[model samples]
Target: MFTGIVQERGEVVALDLAPDGADARVTVRGPLVTQDVQHGESIAVSGVCLTVVASHEDTFTADVMAETLLRTSAKEWAPGRAVNLERSVTPTTRLGGHVVQGHVDGIGTIVARVPHDGYDEFSISVGKDLARYIASKGAVAVDGISLTVIDVNDSPTGAVFTLGIIPETRTATTLGGAAVGSSVNIEVDVMAKYVERLLSFRDVEKA
Candidate 1:
Protein backbone atom coordinates (compact mmCIF):
# COMPACT_ATOMS: atom_id res chain seq x y z
CA MET A 1 0.00 0.00 0.00
CA PHE A 2 1.08 3.59 -0.67
CA THR A 3 0.10 6.88 0.92
CA GLY A 4 0.31 8.80 -2.35
CA ILE A 5 2.76 11.24 -0.84
CA VAL A 6 5.37 11.98 -3.44
CA GLN A 7 8.84 11.70 -1.95
CA GLU A 8 10.97 12.99 -4.78
CA ARG A 9 11.14 13.65 -8.44
CA GLY A 10 13.27 11.14 -10.32
CA GLU A 11 14.82 11.18 -13.74
CA VAL A 12 14.46 8.24 -16.05
CA VAL A 13 17.88 6.83 -16.58
CA ALA A 14 17.03 3.86 -18.74
CA LEU A 15 13.99 2.14 -20.27
CA ASP A 16 14.64 -1.01 -22.25
CA LEU A 17 12.01 -3.40 -23.49
CA ALA A 18 12.36 -6.93 -22.18
CA PRO A 19 12.54 -9.81 -24.66
CA ASP A 20 9.12 -11.15 -23.70
CA GLY A 21 7.55 -8.18 -25.49
CA ALA A 22 5.46 -7.96 -22.33
CA ASP A 23 8.01 -6.60 -19.86
CA ALA A 24 10.51 -3.74 -19.74
CA ARG A 25 13.23 -2.47 -17.44
CA VAL A 26 12.76 0.97 -15.84
CA THR A 27 15.69 2.49 -14.00
CA VAL A 28 15.52 5.76 -12.10
CA ARG A 29 18.02 7.84 -10.14
CA GLY A 30 16.85 9.10 -6.76
CA PRO A 31 19.57 9.64 -4.15
CA LEU A 32 17.76 11.44 -1.31
CA VAL A 33 15.76 8.21 -0.92
CA THR A 34 17.63 5.46 0.86
CA GLN A 35 15.16 3.04 2.38
CA ASP A 36 16.95 -0.26 1.76
CA VAL A 37 14.63 -1.63 -0.91
CA GLN A 38 14.78 -5.38 -1.44
CA HIS A 39 14.75 -7.06 -4.82
CA GLY A 40 11.00 -7.39 -4.65
CA GLU A 41 10.15 -4.20 -2.89
CA SER A 42 7.10 -2.36 -4.17
CA ILE A 43 7.87 1.03 -5.62
CA ALA A 44 5.35 3.55 -6.85
CA VAL A 45 6.56 5.06 -10.10
CA SER A 46 4.25 7.67 -11.46
CA GLY A 47 1.30 5.79 -9.89
CA VAL A 48 2.33 2.32 -11.09
CA CYS A 49 3.28 -0.40 -8.60
CA LEU A 50 6.57 -1.76 -9.91
CA THR A 51 8.50 -4.51 -8.21
CA VAL A 52 12.14 -3.78 -7.73
CA VAL A 53 14.47 -6.16 -9.54
CA ALA A 54 17.63 -4.24 -8.62
CA SER A 55 18.22 -1.45 -6.15
CA HIS A 56 21.05 0.75 -4.92
CA GLU A 57 21.72 3.99 -3.09
CA ASP A 58 20.79 6.16 -6.02
CA THR A 59 19.15 3.89 -8.51
CA PHE A 60 16.76 0.96 -8.83
CA THR A 61 15.54 -1.13 -11.72
CA ALA A 62 12.00 -2.50 -12.01
CA ASP A 63 10.42 -4.66 -14.64
CA VAL A 64 7.12 -3.44 -16.08
CA MET A 65 5.07 -5.74 -18.23
CA ALA A 66 3.24 -4.66 -21.36
CA GLU A 67 -0.01 -4.70 -19.45
CA THR A 68 1.42 -2.27 -16.93
CA LEU A 69 2.98 -0.18 -19.63
CA LEU A 70 -0.28 0.02 -21.54
CA ARG A 71 -2.35 0.58 -18.40
CA THR A 72 -0.19 3.43 -17.11
CA SER A 73 2.17 6.16 -18.24
CA ALA A 74 5.42 4.25 -17.82
CA LYS A 75 5.54 3.71 -21.56
CA GLU A 76 5.65 7.46 -22.09
CA TRP A 77 8.91 7.77 -20.18
CA ALA A 78 12.15 8.44 -22.01
CA PRO A 79 15.72 9.01 -20.89
CA GLY A 80 16.06 12.27 -18.95
CA ARG A 81 12.33 12.61 -18.51
CA ALA A 82 11.06 13.32 -15.00
CA VAL A 83 8.70 11.11 -12.94
CA ASN A 84 7.22 11.06 -9.47
CA LEU A 85 8.83 8.62 -7.02
CA GLU A 86 7.59 7.27 -3.71
CA ARG A 87 8.49 4.34 -1.51
CA SER A 88 5.79 2.14 -0.03
CA VAL A 89 4.48 3.14 3.39
CA THR A 90 6.13 1.67 6.45
CA PRO A 91 4.62 1.23 9.89
CA THR A 92 6.46 4.27 11.19
CA THR A 93 5.50 6.51 8.30
CA ARG A 94 2.73 9.07 8.32
CA LEU A 95 -0.31 8.86 6.09
CA GLY A 96 0.27 12.09 4.22
CA GLY A 97 -1.86 11.12 1.26
CA HIS A 98 -4.78 8.74 0.80
CA VAL A 99 -4.62 5.06 -0.08
CA VAL A 100 -3.15 4.69 -3.55
CA GLN A 101 -2.56 1.33 -5.18
CA GLY A 102 -0.20 2.67 -7.83
CA HIS A 103 -2.45 0.87 -10.26
CA VAL A 104 -3.67 3.08 -13.06
CA ASP A 105 -7.41 2.74 -13.55
CA GLY A 106 -7.33 4.31 -17.00
CA ILE A 107 -5.77 7.03 -19.10
CA GLY A 108 -7.08 10.57 -19.35
CA THR A 109 -6.10 13.66 -21.31
CA ILE A 110 -5.72 17.26 -20.27
CA VAL A 111 -8.48 19.23 -21.93
CA ALA A 112 -7.64 22.68 -20.60
CA ARG A 113 -5.29 24.41 -18.18
CA VAL A 114 -6.44 27.68 -16.74
CA PRO A 115 -3.78 29.79 -15.13
CA HIS A 116 -4.54 32.46 -12.57
CA ASP A 117 -0.99 33.83 -12.23
CA GLY A 118 -0.08 31.94 -9.06
CA TYR A 119 -1.82 28.61 -9.66
CA ASP A 120 -3.66 26.80 -12.38
CA GLU A 121 -6.86 24.79 -12.65
CA PHE A 122 -6.88 22.01 -15.17
CA SER A 123 -9.90 20.30 -16.68
CA ILE A 124 -9.44 16.87 -18.11
CA SER A 125 -11.48 14.38 -20.05
CA VAL A 126 -12.71 11.33 -18.14
CA GLY A 127 -14.95 8.86 -19.88
CA LYS A 128 -17.77 6.66 -18.64
CA ASP A 129 -15.17 3.98 -18.16
CA LEU A 130 -13.55 6.06 -15.40
CA ALA A 131 -16.36 8.43 -14.45
CA ARG A 132 -18.29 6.10 -12.16
CA TYR A 133 -15.53 6.29 -9.58
CA ILE A 134 -15.08 10.04 -9.63
CA ALA A 135 -16.78 12.23 -7.04
CA SER A 136 -16.63 15.93 -6.39
CA LYS A 137 -13.95 16.85 -3.84
CA GLY A 138 -12.76 13.26 -3.95
CA ALA A 139 -9.19 12.13 -4.32
CA VAL A 140 -7.78 11.29 -7.73
CA ALA A 141 -4.28 10.31 -8.60
CA VAL A 142 -2.90 11.89 -11.72
CA ASP A 143 0.51 10.75 -12.84
CA GLY A 144 0.91 9.39 -9.30
CA ILE A 145 0.20 12.64 -7.51
CA SER A 146 -2.90 12.92 -5.35
CA LEU A 147 -5.40 15.56 -6.34
CA THR A 148 -8.96 16.50 -5.51
CA VAL A 149 -11.69 16.62 -8.12
CA ILE A 150 -13.18 20.10 -8.25
CA ASP A 151 -16.10 19.50 -10.56
CA VAL A 152 -17.45 16.91 -12.97
CA ASN A 153 -19.80 16.78 -15.92
CA ASP A 154 -20.79 14.32 -18.58
CA SER A 155 -19.90 14.58 -22.25
CA PRO A 156 -20.72 12.63 -25.34
CA THR A 157 -17.47 10.72 -25.08
CA GLY A 158 -17.06 10.63 -21.30
CA ALA A 159 -16.99 12.70 -18.12
CA VAL A 160 -14.91 15.79 -17.70
CA PHE A 161 -13.42 16.80 -14.35
CA THR A 162 -11.50 19.85 -13.23
CA LEU A 163 -8.56 19.75 -10.88
CA GLY A 164 -6.95 22.62 -9.04
CA ILE A 165 -3.17 22.68 -9.00
CA ILE A 166 -1.22 24.76 -6.59
CA PRO A 167 2.19 26.20 -7.28
CA GLU A 168 3.88 23.52 -5.22
CA THR A 169 2.21 20.76 -7.19
CA ARG A 170 3.10 22.52 -10.40
CA THR A 171 6.74 22.39 -9.36
CA ALA A 172 6.89 19.00 -7.73
CA THR A 173 5.96 16.43 -10.37
CA THR A 174 5.47 16.07 -14.14
CA LEU A 175 2.08 17.72 -13.77
CA GLY A 176 3.94 21.00 -13.64
CA GLY A 177 5.13 20.44 -17.16
CA ALA A 178 1.98 18.83 -18.49
CA ALA A 179 0.24 20.55 -21.36
CA VAL A 180 -3.15 20.31 -22.92
CA GLY A 181 -3.66 17.04 -24.83
CA SER A 182 -1.01 15.40 -22.68
CA SER A 183 -1.98 11.94 -21.52
CA VAL A 184 -2.14 11.36 -17.75
CA ASN A 185 -2.28 8.13 -15.84
CA ILE A 186 -5.24 8.14 -13.44
CA GLU A 187 -5.88 5.95 -10.39
CA VAL A 188 -9.21 6.49 -8.73
CA ASP A 189 -9.84 5.93 -5.03
CA VAL A 190 -9.56 2.32 -3.96
CA MET A 191 -12.77 2.43 -1.96
CA ALA A 192 -14.70 3.56 -4.99
CA LYS A 193 -13.39 0.63 -6.99
CA TYR A 194 -14.28 -1.83 -4.25
CA VAL A 195 -17.78 -0.45 -3.95
CA GLU A 196 -18.27 -0.86 -7.67
CA ARG A 197 -17.02 -4.41 -7.51
CA LEU A 198 -19.45 -5.23 -4.72
CA LEU A 199 -22.31 -3.71 -6.66
CA SER A 200 -21.43 -5.78 -9.72
CA PHE A 201 -21.38 -8.93 -7.65
CA ARG A 202 -24.78 -8.11 -6.19
CA ASP A 203 -26.19 -7.55 -9.67
CA VAL A 204 -24.85 -10.89 -10.84
CA GLU A 205 -26.38 -12.69 -7.86
CA LYS A 206 -29.76 -11.12 -8.52
CA ALA A 207 -29.82 -12.22 -12.15
Candidate 2:
Protein backbone atom coordinates (compact mmCIF):
# COMPACT_ATOMS: atom_id res chain seq x y z
CA MET A 1 0.00 0.00 0.00
CA PHE A 2 1.08 3.59 -0.68
CA THR A 3 -0.12 7.14 -0.22
CA GLY A 4 0.41 8.23 -3.80
CA ILE A 5 2.97 10.74 -2.69
CA VAL A 6 6.02 10.80 -4.90
CA GLN A 7 9.22 11.00 -2.91
CA GLU A 8 11.67 11.06 -5.77
CA ARG A 9 11.86 11.46 -9.49
CA GLY A 10 14.06 8.53 -10.38
CA GLU A 11 15.75 7.82 -13.66
CA VAL A 12 15.82 4.52 -15.45
CA VAL A 13 19.42 3.36 -15.51
CA ALA A 14 18.83 0.27 -17.60
CA LEU A 15 16.17 -2.12 -18.89
CA ASP A 16 16.90 -5.67 -19.99
CA LEU A 17 14.03 -7.54 -21.54
CA ALA A 18 14.03 -11.24 -22.03
CA PRO A 19 14.33 -12.61 -25.53
CA ASP A 20 10.68 -13.60 -25.51
CA GLY A 21 9.66 -10.30 -23.85
CA ALA A 22 7.64 -12.22 -21.31
CA ASP A 23 9.37 -10.28 -18.55
CA ALA A 24 12.15 -7.79 -17.97
CA ARG A 25 14.50 -6.37 -15.36
CA VAL A 26 14.71 -2.64 -14.79
CA THR A 27 17.29 -0.76 -12.77
CA VAL A 28 16.38 2.67 -11.39
CA ARG A 29 18.54 5.24 -9.64
CA GLY A 30 16.59 6.66 -6.72
CA PRO A 31 18.90 7.99 -4.08
CA LEU A 32 16.12 8.83 -1.61
CA VAL A 33 13.98 5.73 -1.94
CA THR A 34 17.02 3.45 -2.06
CA GLN A 35 18.61 4.93 1.03
CA ASP A 36 16.98 2.37 3.34
CA VAL A 37 15.38 0.01 0.88
CA GLN A 38 16.03 -3.71 1.15
CA HIS A 39 15.56 -6.74 -1.01
CA GLY A 40 11.84 -7.70 -1.26
CA GLU A 41 10.69 -4.19 -0.30
CA SER A 42 7.90 -2.81 -2.40
CA ILE A 43 8.35 0.40 -4.34
CA ALA A 44 5.94 2.23 -6.55
CA VAL A 45 7.82 3.03 -9.72
CA SER A 46 5.70 5.25 -11.92
CA GLY A 47 2.61 3.77 -10.23
CA VAL A 48 3.57 0.10 -10.68
CA CYS A 49 4.23 -1.81 -7.48
CA LEU A 50 7.56 -3.53 -7.99
CA THR A 51 9.56 -5.58 -5.54
CA VAL A 52 13.20 -4.80 -5.10
CA VAL A 53 15.31 -7.78 -6.10
CA ALA A 54 18.65 -6.06 -5.53
CA SER A 55 19.74 -2.84 -3.93
CA HIS A 56 23.12 -1.30 -4.61
CA GLU A 57 24.19 2.18 -3.65
CA ASP A 58 21.60 4.55 -5.06
CA THR A 59 20.11 2.10 -7.51
CA PHE A 60 17.70 -0.81 -7.22
CA THR A 61 16.46 -3.42 -9.65
CA ALA A 62 13.02 -4.99 -10.04
CA ASP A 63 11.44 -7.46 -12.37
CA VAL A 64 8.45 -6.49 -14.52
CA MET A 65 6.14 -9.24 -15.61
CA ALA A 66 4.20 -9.37 -18.86
CA GLU A 67 0.97 -8.42 -17.11
CA THR A 68 2.48 -5.18 -15.92
CA LEU A 69 3.86 -4.39 -19.33
CA LEU A 70 0.47 -4.92 -20.92
CA ARG A 71 -1.41 -2.71 -18.48
CA THR A 72 1.05 0.09 -17.88
CA SER A 73 3.39 2.50 -19.57
CA ALA A 74 6.31 0.37 -18.43
CA LYS A 75 6.47 -1.20 -21.87
CA GLU A 76 7.68 2.15 -23.19
CA TRP A 77 10.24 2.74 -20.47
CA ALA A 78 13.83 3.17 -21.58
CA PRO A 79 17.16 4.37 -20.31
CA GLY A 80 17.09 7.97 -19.06
CA ARG A 81 13.30 8.01 -18.76
CA ALA A 82 12.19 9.74 -15.56
CA VAL A 83 9.89 7.80 -13.25
CA ASN A 84 8.03 8.68 -10.05
CA LEU A 85 9.27 6.74 -7.02
CA GLU A 86 7.43 6.16 -3.74
CA ARG A 87 8.12 3.63 -1.03
CA SER A 88 5.35 1.73 0.67
CA VAL A 89 3.66 3.55 3.53
CA THR A 90 4.37 2.58 7.10
CA PRO A 91 1.88 2.38 9.92
CA THR A 92 3.04 5.76 11.17
CA THR A 93 3.14 7.37 7.76
CA ARG A 94 0.83 10.32 7.17
CA LEU A 95 -1.99 9.84 4.71
CA GLY A 96 -1.11 12.90 2.71
CA GLY A 97 -2.87 11.58 -0.32
CA HIS A 98 -5.33 8.67 -0.42
CA VAL A 99 -5.18 4.91 -0.33
CA VAL A 100 -3.10 3.98 -3.34
CA GLN A 101 -2.39 0.31 -3.87
CA GLY A 102 0.11 1.10 -6.60
CA HIS A 103 -1.82 -1.37 -8.66
CA VAL A 104 -2.31 0.48 -11.94
CA ASP A 105 -5.80 -0.06 -13.23
CA GLY A 106 -5.02 0.94 -16.79
CA ILE A 107 -3.07 3.25 -19.07
CA GLY A 108 -4.32 6.73 -19.93
CA THR A 109 -3.26 9.07 -22.70
CA ILE A 110 -2.81 12.79 -22.29
CA VAL A 111 -5.03 14.40 -24.87
CA ALA A 112 -4.98 18.04 -23.92
CA ARG A 113 -3.19 20.54 -21.69
CA VAL A 114 -4.29 24.02 -20.84
CA PRO A 115 -2.56 26.56 -18.70
CA HIS A 116 -4.38 28.34 -15.88
CA ASP A 117 -3.57 31.26 -13.63
CA GLY A 118 -1.31 29.36 -11.25
CA TYR A 119 -1.74 25.82 -12.46
CA ASP A 120 -2.25 23.68 -15.52
CA GLU A 121 -5.19 21.51 -16.42
CA PHE A 122 -4.54 18.28 -18.27
CA SER A 123 -7.18 16.21 -19.97
CA ILE A 124 -6.54 12.49 -20.28
CA SER A 125 -8.46 9.86 -22.17
CA VAL A 126 -9.08 6.51 -20.56
CA GLY A 127 -10.98 3.42 -21.51
CA LYS A 128 -14.54 3.13 -20.24
CA ASP A 129 -13.54 0.18 -18.12
CA LEU A 130 -11.33 2.45 -16.09
CA ALA A 131 -13.31 5.65 -16.45
CA ARG A 132 -16.37 4.14 -14.84
CA TYR A 133 -14.60 4.44 -11.52
CA ILE A 134 -13.71 8.11 -12.01
CA ALA A 135 -15.87 11.05 -10.93
CA SER A 136 -15.47 14.76 -10.60
CA LYS A 137 -13.63 15.76 -7.41
CA GLY A 138 -12.63 12.14 -6.91
CA ALA A 139 -9.05 11.03 -6.51
CA VAL A 140 -6.95 9.25 -9.08
CA ALA A 141 -3.32 8.33 -9.04
CA VAL A 142 -1.46 9.28 -12.19
CA ASP A 143 2.06 7.97 -12.38
CA GLY A 144 2.01 7.58 -8.60
CA ILE A 145 0.94 11.15 -7.91
CA SER A 146 -2.48 11.56 -6.40
CA LEU A 147 -4.64 14.15 -8.20
CA THR A 148 -8.22 15.26 -8.01
CA VAL A 149 -10.37 14.91 -11.07
CA ILE A 150 -11.72 18.27 -12.19
CA ASP A 151 -14.27 16.94 -14.62
CA VAL A 152 -15.20 13.92 -16.70
CA ASN A 153 -16.64 13.73 -20.15
CA ASP A 154 -17.97 10.57 -21.65
CA SER A 155 -17.19 9.91 -25.27
CA PRO A 156 -18.18 7.36 -27.83
CA THR A 157 -14.94 5.46 -27.45
CA GLY A 158 -14.10 6.18 -23.83
CA ALA A 159 -13.95 9.06 -21.35
CA VAL A 160 -11.80 12.13 -20.95
CA PHE A 161 -11.08 13.42 -17.46
CA THR A 162 -9.45 16.66 -16.46
CA LEU A 163 -7.01 17.35 -13.63
CA GLY A 164 -5.50 20.45 -12.11
CA ILE A 165 -1.76 20.23 -11.56
CA ILE A 166 -0.06 22.80 -9.46
CA PRO A 167 3.45 24.07 -10.06
CA GLU A 168 4.77 22.07 -7.16
CA THR A 169 3.55 18.78 -8.54
CA ARG A 170 4.71 19.64 -12.04
CA THR A 171 8.24 20.41 -10.91
CA ALA A 172 8.63 17.51 -8.51
CA THR A 173 7.41 14.56 -10.61
CA THR A 174 7.73 12.97 -14.03
CA LEU A 175 4.51 14.64 -15.06
CA GLY A 176 6.42 17.89 -15.31
CA GLY A 177 7.69 16.88 -18.71
CA ALA A 178 4.74 14.83 -19.89
CA ALA A 179 3.55 15.96 -23.28
CA VAL A 180 0.38 15.41 -25.20
CA GLY A 181 -0.06 11.82 -26.36
CA SER A 182 2.21 10.56 -23.62
CA SER A 183 1.09 7.38 -21.90
CA VAL A 184 0.72 7.29 -18.13
CA ASN A 185 -0.18 4.63 -15.61
CA ILE A 186 -3.48 5.42 -13.86
CA GLU A 187 -4.92 3.92 -10.67
CA VAL A 188 -8.44 4.96 -9.83
CA ASP A 189 -9.56 5.30 -6.22
CA VAL A 190 -9.77 1.81 -4.73
CA MET A 191 -12.81 2.75 -2.65
CA ALA A 192 -14.90 3.28 -5.78
CA LYS A 193 -14.15 -0.21 -7.01
CA TYR A 194 -15.00 -1.71 -3.67
CA VAL A 195 -18.26 0.20 -3.54
CA GLU A 196 -19.21 -1.06 -6.98
CA ARG A 197 -18.44 -4.63 -5.98
CA LEU A 198 -20.54 -4.34 -2.85
CA LEU A 199 -23.47 -2.86 -4.75
CA SER A 200 -23.39 -5.73 -7.23
CA PHE A 201 -23.95 -8.19 -4.41
CA ARG A 202 -26.93 -6.16 -3.22
CA ASP A 203 -28.39 -6.33 -6.73
CA VAL A 204 -27.92 -10.07 -6.77
CA GLU A 205 -29.72 -10.37 -3.46
CA LYS A 206 -32.60 -8.21 -4.67
CA ALA A 207 -33.03 -10.49 -7.71
The per-model lDDT (C-alpha) reads 0.87, 0.95
Candidate 1 regions exceeding 4 Å error are none
Off by over 4 Å in 2: none
Residue-level error in angstroms, candidate 1, position 8: 0.4
Q: Candidate 1, residues 66-170: lDDT per residue as tens digits?
A: 899888778888899888888888899998888888889999999999998778999989788999888999999988888889999887778999999989988
Q: Candidate 2's residue-wise lDDT over 1-207, tens digit each?
A: 999989999999998999999889999999999999999999999999999999999999999999998899999999999999999999999999999998999999999999999999999999989979999999999999999999999987889999999999999998889999999999999989999999999999999
Clashing pairs in 1: 22-66
Top lDDT prediction, candidate number: 2
TM-score of 2: 0.98
